[model samples]
Target: MNRILATARVQLAAWPSTLGMPWLVLGGAFLVNLMVFALINTSNEDAHTGGLVTFYVVVLVAYVVTMTQYFPMILGMSVTRRTFYLATCLMALVQSLGYGAVLTVLELVESATGGWGVSLPFFGVEFLQQSNVLLQLLAYAVPTLLVSSLGMFFGVTFKRWGVIGMYTLAIASLVVFGGLAVLVTWLRWWGAIGAWFADQSSLALLAGWPALLTLVLAAVNFLMLRRATP
Candidate 1:
């Protein structure tokens, strides 16, 4: 147990420089939240909806970037997969909770100030159970797991994290984003979080499925790493 946490701590400390990126990302996200509160013209409900969608997309992107940084680091490190995966998810969600709080407060302030009213995502176990929360989460997590797993595979295969990160990002961008845009354009999700979002009921029943899937992929990649050893 102690060793699991120790491994997580080591993963956290491994990148002293990338540590601040989350803070910077959160700060920028907060500012955008404030701006949407203050500047957006919201004379109608659709305007409000648009503003909220914008907020969702921005936060999603922030999570992806943060996850991108920490995900690969954890994947590449010599640590227990359980420790690495849980720690990264906890840290990422903690940061998301903070961002959500700031946005929630700003939304209230905007309403008070007669600006566009927006509701930030609430934090807590309740929020986690909301309709497609799992979907929303896995929307980000799917691509993350894929990229992180592939990155580890390539990094271990080639013995170079940077090269792997670069090429993987490029390929992932070309494929994932491209597919999503086309899909969402051709078939809108109504209130759904696009096709990438998983069903919460399904996800809840299959607790640890994400971690289980990630672990299996990681193990497969680890096997590759071992076999490639000279």
Candidate 2:
């Protein structure tokens, strides 16, 4: 347990990229959105931008770097693969919770201030609005976990199998999804799929299913890391 925590600290040692970059990216995106929205003369109170996605993208890329850059270095320093993986998971959970809370606060402020006084809903977007604070936090955090797990999975794949492994993974994913798309088209399941999504609440769609997927991806990432070369 101590070793795992130590490994997590080691990962956090690169604070600039690991802890700072996401917020920096998010701040930049927010500024851009604020400027653009302020400049527009539309009276649409429902106007919103997907700028929040920048934070998640930065997090995903940061975890990819964790596997590609930090993994090798940490292993060289005598950390076990299991320790590193656990540490990575711990960091993901902690960071997700922190980010979720921050986002929730931002959402509240945005709502109270009427979208920063511009009538723009950058943080409190309509689709994601939740009356329950915990649910709202989960909605934001779960996707972060899912994306971080995805990045870790990709990084471990590279470490385990190198460039060829990545290419193979990409090709396999395309084939599987492409095949599923073809099957769905043939079976005329598009309507059912759309209906299934429509049946789910925003929280369920954003947090529930993604939480399960994150668990699956985390398991797979650990397995891959077990066999991965530094």
Per-model TM-score on C-alpha atoms = 0.41, 0.97
Candidate 1 local lDDT, 1-230, one digit each (tens): 66556655754574433344534555565557546645654344333223233334443444344334554565566654456545644554454445445544544454455543333321112233224444445433343344444444444444434557558757988999889878877886644773334464544433345556656766765554443322
Candidate 2 per-residue lDDT, tens place, 149-182, comes to 9889888888999999989989999999999999
Off by over 4 Å in 1: 14-20, 47-216, 225-230
TM-score of 1: 0.41
- The predictions' CA RMSDs to the true structure, in order, are 8.4, 1.1
Candidate 2 runs further than 4 Å off: none
lDDT of 2 at 223: 88
Taken over the whole model, the C-alpha lDDT of each candidate is 0.47, 0.90
Best by TM-score: 2
Clashing pairs in 1: 135-198
For model 1, what is the error of residue 141's alpha carbon versus the real structure, in angstroms, after optimal superposition?
8.2
